[model samples]
Structures are given as structure tokens and as C-alpha cells.
Target chain A: MTTAPLGQLPGQTRRGERILIGLAVGLTLLFIAAPLVFIFVRAFAQGWQVYAANILHPATLHAIWLTTITAIIVVPLNVGFGIAAAWAVAKHRFPGRGILVTLIEIPFSISPIIAGICYLLLYGRQGLLGPWLQANDIQVVFALPGIVLVTMFVTAPFVAREVLPLMQAQGSEQEQAAVTLGANGWQIFTRVTLPNIKWALLYGAVLCTARAVGEFGGVSVVSGNIRGQTNTLPLHVELLFNDLNAVGAFAAASTLTLIAVVALVIKAILEGRRQS
Target chain B: MTAAATHTGAPIRAKRVLPGFTLSLGTTLLYMTFIVLIPVITLILKGAEIGPERFWRIISSPRAVAAFQITLTAALIATAFNAIYGLLMAWVLVRYEFRGKRILDALMDVPFALPTAVAGLSLTALFSANGWFGPVLDAMGIQVVYTIWGIALAMAFTSVPFVVRTVQPVLEDMDPALEQAALTLGARPWAIFTRVVFPAILPAWLAGCTTAFARSLGEFGAIVFIAGNLPFRTEIAALLAYIRLEEFDYNGAAAIALVLLAFALVLLVVSNVLQAWASRHREASR
Candidate 1:
């Protein structure tokens, strides 16, 4: 069936179908590709010096530092969470397994804006734990910790979502086999399960990193847009744009755009290798 | 099997074979509770604190209603466009062989990878009156930036990938025999698609569109840049919620946030139902 010539044979394109595909691809090129190109074009519109100056601007550099720090903190934690969650759900038969999976997915369905607001309401100076937090002299909302917290919230499901299905499909047979041979659980997992899932784990990690760095709504609400303090790359782009510094905004945006392109390139290569 | 017994003649203790279940599950649940559940629970509690009357008053206010209307309408428009464009893109991807097809497939994920803020900025630049496409559009008197159309465009850009990716796999997996059978019966290409191929992929397509719509509803970063955010004219519900929070009106923010949350939850339920239906149909078809 896979080799059959009956299903959508190449070179049999009908005129109407050709037109349809053309129209669709054309729309994508216009809407999707055009904007992407426009970012780079506009970023360099004033020449490389201006672009470099905008990029090396103190606030932009600070935003980059913050974004990188947030991703550095958030990705590994989520990777750990993903491994644990995937192991529990995929390797064990438990009551409420479905509920556990659904619970993990809660953040996915919730709006990032709401996720931000939820954190603010819980930790803001006027929030439920506001007085307690203030007395302790700890800041969450409008600070670095709040930015990390919300980024974690928004990017929570990526690693697990990517790795879970693969683990479930692979099953626990190998682990059981290793156990029968007197292999310790950790030994079996490290020697066997981890190797099998390493690719998926990396894929998930890449996705998590991209999302953590690019996240805006959740981080925006919590970061308070404090220049050179809590502002992330995304927030900096907005601040520049709001200040009507179009060149600076797009230049900062280009850095983010660069990260995204690199991510896409890596993801594409991984996907290609996976297919092979 | 014999390895389980021969090494230990002193009787094998039935230590659980798959260890770490308790520890892994414990950590997973604990982390989820602290990070995700607690904050969400706080939002719900806050929303409930405002009595039903006040909740209704906030949600029913003209500004809130307009936000909802604008969000829903834009999402609907985006979904409608994606339904056609996405299906075609999927068809092109699955059926035809072309140079750079692999690159094209990868390109679909750019919106997912690109920061929404970046997408918003670039799109606004491209469509604003002074931008490249902006001047052409201006000639046509079609203002996209700071308009509802811009909001819809942003939504469409960000969400179309859902439709394409979802439908692509299903379409690729479909058996050739189904289409062949239809063709053998003298069905035209369109007829075969409508009668055989379409039905096979319809459930998944619908599921994809629902998810796309759901995603569009929650979109904030991309839309906020393009949307003029005039309260009764262009502001989206997500932005409204954020605005309410900025003003320190916790009740107002919670109220609007709750509405968006409820909408998302409802869409999720609907999409899950469609997904289940799709799976059941696939099973029956097989």
C-alpha cells in the first residue's frame, strides 16, 4: 500500500488543483515568508553599523542577558520535569493516569496572559501572598524570579509533550528485561531508556529553549518592563517599538529572529534525520 | 526469564521491576502543583470572589463585550482562511514531490519558533503605511495595522501551522486504496476527493481548525502590536485582561481573564471531542 501508485500520484496534478496549491503557497509566501524577510530587511535598512549599534545598545544587551538567563534556568528544570512525568505516565500503570496527563496539559490550554495574571495575583505586592512575600523581603512579580516562574509555566508542557508519546510507544519491556538480568533501575534507565529517548529529549529541549526565550505575554506581565533589570528580549522589542524607536525595535527583534531561524534550522535537521 | 532465578537461589525479592515510579510521580505532581495548579487555582478563586452580579457586570460591560466580539470574530476569520489554505498546503505537501519540499515543510514551524513579539513587530512593519507592503496596501486604502483585519492577519499567521501540521500527518497516512476505489468507479478528481479523501480526513481537519481557533483566541503578543487596542473597536480579550491587570483592577482582570480562560477550556473540550471522533472513525474505517 505504501508503494501503490493509486494515492495522489506525483505529476498527475490537475489544473484546478494546481491553481489551488499555487494560491495556497502564494498566500503563505505573501503572509508568512514576506513578514519574515521583512524583519531582516528592515533590520539592515540603515546599514550594518546602525544594526550593530542598536543591538549593542545597553538595554538590548541587558534584555538578551535576561532572556538567556531565563532560558538557562527554565529549560533544564522543565527537562527534569518532562523526564519524570514521561517516565511515570509511560512506564507505569496507575489509577488516575489520564488525570495526570490532563493536569500536565493544563498550562497548554490556558492563555499565557492568564498564566501571567495568575502569577501576579498570587505573588504581586497586592496579591494573596503579597503581605507575606513583602515581609520576607522577597520579590516575585515585577522581578527576575517572576520572569523565570512565568516562562517555566508557559513552556512547561513542551518537553513532556514531545517525549511522552515516544516513551509510551517504546514501552517498559526493555526495562523489565533488564530487571530480570539483575540490572538496577537507574542502570537500566541510563544504559537503555535514556539512549532510546535521547533524541526526543533533545528535541524537546530545543523546543523548550525556543519558547522560554521567545515568551512575551507571561514574562511581560511579570517582568514589569524594568529596563536593564527584568526586561527580556521580547519585552525590549516592545519597549523600543513603544518609544517609537523603530530601528532599535526591529534590530532587537532581529536578534530574536536570528534565534528563531537557528532553532528552525536545527529542528528541520533533526526532523529530517528522524525520518531517515 | 531464567536469569531472574539462577543468580539468586535464595529467592528473588519482588522489588518492583520498574522502579522510580513513586519518586518520579511524586516529583512530577509536586512540581505541577506548585508551578501550574496553584496559580490557576488562585485565578479561579479570585474570579469567584467577585459575586456573580459583579462578574456579569464586568463581562457584560460594553468594553469587555467588544473585546470578546473582536477576538471571536478575528479568530473565526482566521480559522476560515486556514481551513482552505491549510488543506491546500497539506495536499500540496503530501501529494506532490518538489525540490525544497523538505525546506517548505520546515518553514511551516517558523511562526512557532519566532517570538510572537517578533512576528508582531515584523508584520506591523510590513503592513504599516510606511512599510513595504504597507504602501501598496495604502494605495488600495486597505489599512491593516491598527485594525481588526490586522488582528485577524496576526492570528492567521500564528495559528495556520496547527491546521497544516495536524492535517498533513493524517493525509499522509491515508491508504491509497480508498482513493483508487473511488477512481475505479469513474469518479472525477474532485469527486474522489469529496467522496473519499475528504471524508477520511474531515475529522482531523475539523479538529485542527478547532485547535487553531482556540490558539488564536489566546494569542496576545502578536495581536497587541497590530491591534490599535481601541476598547470598543479593536482590543482583544487577552489584551483587555492584561490592561485590567495593569490598572491593578484584580477583579476586572480576573473577570476578563476568566472569560478567555473559559473560552479556551471550552475550545479544548470541543477539540478533544473532535479528536476522539476522528480516532474512532479511523478505527471504523480500517
Candidate 2:
């Protein structure tokens, strides 16, 4: 099932297959690489001094900082929530388990922009919780808290999707054995379940972090694009672009492209290892 | 260890790391209700606030109707393109080994990682009248950017991975013996694929296509930058929704959103059914 089938063909057929495969692969690479290459070429063509100046600009620096802060807060919180949800869904078999599984995947179907609207409907001034929150002077929209909340909502499913399948496949045998041998619930989970799921959890975390960092639509709606304050890296790129600072826009975009490339590399490596 | 066994009155004490299934299930339901269901319900509720006549007016207005038509047409074209290309890419990756195979495989995920906004901008730059390929197309009098083709291009870029990712796994898990036996009986590669391989993977391919369509339908960040936001020409439904939001017409925004939500829900159900049917087929074949 895993072996390459083209190797079994006749020499001419094999050569033809190779050429076809080469063409397909070549086009795919060109399509994927063109934008990243264009950004780099455009960014550096003007010289390093211009690029450095843009990088050091306060607004640009703040955008990067705000994005990092959001990631720091959102990633761990989602990881915790994801683990809890996955633990419940994977190990349990009560009524509504199917519905819970379906519910966990709702974020996938819902647009990030809609996710922003959802938050607005819940926490906006005219929202269900708006009065209470406003009375307490808690600003959720056009604020950092709002930005993080929507981001969290958008990325909530990643870790759970990763952890759920692995947990279900592994089942409760090991955990049961540990419990029967005198380990308590917490100890069994810590000593057995956690260790087993560590790699998958890390993989999921990497994906979630990448998404949280790159997230723009949901965050944009709530962040208000307040320069140097609520702006994320993606928004910063847009801001620079809109400001007609083409050089700065490409520079920031290149930085994000680099992060995305790194994340892709990590994901590919992890997936490859799992396959082998 | 038998502490529960010694207790005659109590049902077998359930020893578990997490709470009982009922409690956990309840928690999951409550959380999803508060977070997902409520917001979605509110979106529809807001739309309903506009009386039926007004709701119909909002959705059927010239600009809004054009946006819907353009969005649907571009999504259909892009998804069709992806259905063919993605299948080829998946087949090549799963069935062949060549130099740079690993690199090619990794590149499939570029759209997913790259922010949609950046993708839209870069594609516009690449295909616009002044872009690298734009001048070449201009010689032949072809326009892309700020046109329907540009919208399709943006949609295609973001949607390519959906079909590829969905089909690749099914292709990988497919037993090679079936193909080998067919070939041994003197069947040609095309016949074997069309007769045997295609049928097996058809359900998954259809599912992937539906997902790609749904994704393209909702895509905004990328399309907005490239679509030129021209009413009745390039404006998409999602952009219309945003326009309504920007205009502070919450009723209109909610109405458009409801249309998108309904479309998405239908696609979701269809894909789920296709996936379920495909898995059942695999089991029966086994």
C-alpha cells in the first residue's frame, strides 16, 4: 500500500511518468513560492537601510509585540480548554457524545469573521452581556481582551482535533491498568495519559500558535486596528500597505511569511514522523 | 482495590480520571450552547428583526444580489478547478516517488499557513495588469485582477489544500492489491483507475469538493483586496456582509450572514453524508 507504483512500469512509461510528475511538482512549487519570493525581492530591492528603518518604527514594533502578547495568552488558555474538552469527548460514551463531538467542530465551519460577529453579539454594547459588562466598566470590544477572546474562539478546535483522535485510538487500557495498580486519577493522568499525548499536544500547540499569530479577520473586527496598540502583525502589514509604505508592508509581510514557512516545516516534519 | 465491591448499596463506584460521562457530556453541551449556538442564534435573530419584506429587500437589492451571484459563480469555478488539480496532486504525491517529492508535498500547505490577506495582495500583484504574467496576458487582451478571474484565482489559492488534504489520506490507505490484480488481468492503468480506483475515492473527492466550495464561499480577507469591491461586478457576498457591517446596517448584515450560514450548513451536511457513505463502503469492501 505504501510503495510507489511507478517504479514497476516499463522504462518508457516510467520516464513519461517522471516527466509528468516533474511538471506537476514544478508548477506546484512555483505557484506556492512566487508570492514569498516576490515579497523578499520587493522588500530588499530598495536596500537594507530602508528595511531596518521600517523595522525599528514604533508602530511596526508595537504590532509585533501585541501579536506576540496575544499568542502568549491565547495558546496556553486554548491548550487547557482543548485538553479538557478532548478528555471529556474521547473517554466518555454517554448520551450526546456524538453531539459534543460535532459541537467541537463547529468552529471549523464558522468563519473567523463570523466568530468576530459572534463575540460582538455576545459582548458588544447592545449584546446579551453588554449591560452587565459595561456596568462593571469591562470593555470587551475594540480592546485587547476582545482581540484575545475572538482569537481564542477561532483557534479552540486545533488542539482538541489533534488530541481527540489519538486519545480515542489509544483507549483507556493503559490508564485503567495504572488505576488498578493503585494510582489515583490525577497520578494516572499525569503519569500515563499526559506522557502519551505529549507529542500530539505539542504538535497541536504549534499549529494553534501559528493560527493565533496569523489570525486577522476575527482580531481585526475586535482590535479596531488601533495602531501600535491593538494591531497584530497581519494588521500591521495591512496598515503599512494602506499607508502606501510598500516597503514596510512587504517587510512585515515577509516576516510573517517566514514564520508561516517555519510552522509549515515543523508541521511537515511532525506529520512525516507520525507516518513513518 | 475492591473497595467498591465491598459496598453492597452503591452501584459499582465509577473510578475515573475525568468525571462521569454524563457530567462531561453536559459540560460540553453547555459550553457549546453558550459559545457557538447562542451567537449563531443571535445572528439569525437579528436578521429576523427585519420583517420578512425588509429581509427580502435587503437580500434581493441589486448590489446584494449581484454579490451573491458573483460569489456563487466564482466559488463554483474555483472548486471545479480544485477538484481536478487537487486530485492530480494528491494522486501524484501518494502514488509516486521522485526527487523533491517531500518539498512538493510540503508546499501543498502554503495557502493554509500564509494569511489570506497577504495571499490576496500578492496574487493581485502577480496577476494584475502590471504584474509578472499580467503583461503577457495583456498582449492577448486578457484581464485578471479586479475581475472575476482574479476572484477565482484568490479562491483557488486558498482552496487548493482542502481537496488535496482530504483525498491524499484516502488514496494512501487504499489497498494496492486491488489495482495490481486488475492490472494482472490485463486492465490498462486508465481503465483500472476509472473502474476501480475512481469509484472508491469518488465519495471522498466529492466531499473535498464540497468543503472547498464552502470555504471559497466564505473567503473574504483574500478576495476583498483583489475583488476591487465593485458592486454588481466583482463584489462577493462576504464582502457585502462586511459592507453592511461597515454601514451599520445590522439587519442587512445579519440577513447576508444568514444566507452564508445556511449555505455552509447545507454543504456541511452533504459532506458529512458523503464521508459517512465512503467509510461504510470501505468497510463493506473489506
Candidate 3:
């Protein structure tokens, strides 16, 4: 038998339900759906040849490559940290646990532009570490290293935040059981804990990858916007837009939009896996 | 029920068995210190080098004050819209059944997944004078691009999922029996929502709103394109800091960033406290 919704009683008219649903659908269409549709529309506004050329452009290719490399390096490091942080916080009780979580979450609240500025202060030629770096003749800001570092900083908390909750809820019972049965730490983690938490770990990595690939403000600050060099896909979009190349900008954006959609689809599947 | 286990004269702690506590916690702390902590310290140090007087002067300048005002105003406007829109969206998602609900749910996270620059670009294009919504809005005397409203729109778009995600699970887990009881008591739907439902989700909703506001304050990418970046007008505090850095005015950049950083830290603490209080309240009620 079908049960009535909580706020919907027999006394409520059908018209009221229709209106509420209509408003939500309409606004969602305007705010969320429309932008998504327009991305593709604008991307192809100049037709097939232009869209193909924009995507195949050398600068665009370099941007996609740079974005890929950044995500490749950033996601694994953050995922490793995520697992370690979750293991520490969830499996064991310790003093200052609360503080650690807050530290991890600092990036979520701070502006990305501020994150880039902070990196600059440490690594810029005249920064605190500037003299040391100059003596070493090592460039951090306005380079690939700077881009990676800031992306790492901005995305540091993703995996740990996602995995920590699931780990906490699962507790250490299975791990304890494994230890009682003579499993070593590595063995227990690999054979028991990994199988259980793998979905969450992957979920976090998906999000981290998406964020790393799309990072803009922070990366922009440090990358120096060197065309065909330190530029990423997101930065390329900005560069294209500012150059009055709206079609090319939208073309680049449509690629990122496609990536986002893929990420969401994967995220949805993982959410289902995680629930079951 | 079985009797509770009695404690011995001296409480005995369980022997630690899990490996990697030291290894794991050490890596976490060391990585965090290097990646997150040290950079932040440098920013603070950079700001401190300006000395109190100069820091004050830099932040109190007309341009700086105006940027802060615009940032706060736009953030407030964005947060206000998200507060109502978020609640309604959450309510609809949780309480109503409709086609494309799954798609709608997935789309809620686009703002999170989509790159900010793309969001900014697409939004600007969509709302610019010659674009689709631009003409409609322009004809209606409602300009979005390069205006405060545009900034707020971008802010709201990018932060759409904050409240929805936070409040969704809470709404899903809420005890519907109370609402059913209220309905049987002959209460209006609005009354039931206000009295019976809203209270249950109030802490989560507030926490969500606060986080959304903090995010709006820090937002840079989605805003810059649409905001027009007009000095003392569309320019936000973050953009001002970026401009300072571009001019090699490290001191000025640090001073402004320090203000934004402080806002973030305070809001972080507030959001954390509200979340803790929410869980505690839920536990207490249970």
C-alpha cells in the first residue's frame, strides 16, 4: 500500500502539490539546468568546424595535458593522506583529534585566491623562502610546481573528509577481529579494511580528481598564466574569454562540463554502492 | 537487559592493538603542517611584516573598504537566496515525488563539480546583453551581468549544493510520525512545517547557510567574470588582494587576504560549533 507523504495529508488540495512541484522544477531549470544546456549551445554556436578546431588547438591540448598531470599527482597524494588521516581518527581515539579534523577542513572555508597568495609568500622570489630558492635557483611560483602545490593545498581535505565519516561509522570491530586472528597491520588493512572502505576511498578520489582538474583561482595566482606552459583547462577558459574568443572559451568550458558530468555520474554510482 | 559491567577499583584501559596509529597520525600531521599549516603561517607572517599601523591603513583605505562592503553585500544577498531556495529545494527533494528526481539530485552537485571559470563564463554569456537570458532580463529592467545581482547569481549558482547536501540527509532521517501527528491534530501544512518540521532541521539549515555564506565570501572565479571587476564597485575583497599581488604590493595583498582569512576562520569555527550542536541535539532527542 502507498502511504501519504509526511506534509501531505488528505486535507491538502492537489493544486497545492502541483504548484510546489512546479516552482521547484521551474527554478531548477533556470538556475542549474539552463547553464548546463547553454554551455553546449555556446560551444557549438559557431558550428562543428570551429568547435573541433578549438578543442584540437595546441594551447587547449597543452592545457588538458597540464590539468591531467596535476590531477594525476595531486589525487594520489591526497588519497594517501585521506586514508592515513581516517585511519588515525577513526580507528583510534586520541587527544587533539578534534583539532586535526579542523586543520584538515581549513581549505574548505578559505578562498582559493588566498591559498595561492599564501603559497606565493613562501615560494615567491622575494618571499620568506625566496632567498633560499633563489640561491638554489629553483622557481616555485609561476610554474608547474606552483600549480601542483596550490592544487594540493586546495584539495587536501577531500578524501579524508569523505572517508573519515564512513570509517567512523564502521568502527574498528572488524580490524580488531582481524588482529585477534593474527593478521598483521598490513594484512588486516589490505584484506579486511580495504574491501569494506574501498568504495568510500574511490568516492573521495573521484571528487578530489574533479577538484584538482577544475581548480582555477588558486592555480591562476601561481601559474603566471603562461600560454602553452603552465595554463590549465580552467585557466585556458579564462584566457580565451579575456581574449574575446568567446566561442573558444565556451568550447574549452564544454570539455570541463563534460568532465563534471562524468564525475557526477560516477559519484552517483558510488553513492549507490556506498549505501548498499 | 543484562546488568552493566562494573568497573574495577582502577579503570583498566584496553591495550592498543591496531597498528599505524603513530605512522598514520604522523603522516597526516606532517603532511598537513607542510601543505596547509606552513603556507598559512607565511601569509600571517607576511601580513604581520606590514606592522599594525600599515596593516590598518591598507585595509581601511577607501577602495579596500568599498571592496569589503560589496563582498559582504553580495554574499548576504547570495546567502539569503540560497537559504530559502535551498530549504525549498531540500523540502521538495525529500518530501515530494517527481519524475527526473534522480537527475535533479545529481544536478544539485554540478556547482561543486563544474569549474568555477566555466561557471563564470557560461553564466556571463547567458546573462550578457546579447545572450539568451540577457535580453529577457534587460527588457524587464533586470540586469545581471556586471552587476551586484550577477555576482550574487554566480555565488548562488556555485554554492547551490551546500545547503541541499547538508540538510538533505537530515530531512531524510527525520521522524515523519511527528508530522503525521500534527496533521491529524488539524494543523495547517504551514503550521506543521513551522512547528513540527522546521525545528528539527533548524540547526542543519543554519549551519548550511553559514557555510554557504562563508563560501560566497571566498568565491573568486565564478564572480570575477560576471562582477565586471570595476574598482570600488564590482571588485570583491579577494580580487583586490589578487590585484595587490599583481602589482607586487605584497604588503597590501597580505593585509586584505588577512581580513578574508579571519572571516573564513571565524565562520569555520561557527559552522563546526553549529554542526556539533546539531548532532548533540539529535542525540539528546533520541
DockQ per candidate: 0.64, 0.46, 0.63
Q: Candidate 2: where is the Cα deviation over 4 Å?
A: A1-7, A10-12, B5-31
Q: Which candidate is the best by DockQ?
A: 1
State the TM-score of candidate 1 restricted to chain B.
0.93
lDDT of 3 by residue, A100-124 (tens): 8889889999899999999999999
Question: Could you give the CAPRI-style class of model 3?
Answer: medium
Write the candidate numbers in order of decreasing TM-score. 3, 1, 2
Q: Which pairs clash in model 2?
A: none
Q: Is model 2 an incorrect, acceptable, medium or high docking prediction?
A: acceptable
Model 1 chain A lowest lDDT segment of ten = A1-10
lDDT to native, each model: 0.88, 0.80, 0.90
lDDT of 2 by residue, B42-81 (tens): 7777766778999999899998989999999999999999
Best by TM-score: 3
Per-residue CA lDDT of candidate 2, range A1-276, in tens? 233363264343577677769777767855677866777777776899988888888988888888889999989977876777777877755556777777788777777777777677678887778999999999988888998888887888888899889999998778656755777666867898899888789889988988888887777776778887788888888788778787898888777778888888888888777777
Question: What stretches of model 3 exceed 4 Å from their correct place?
Answer: A1-8, B1-15
Q: What order do candidates take by lDDT, descending?
A: 3, 1, 2
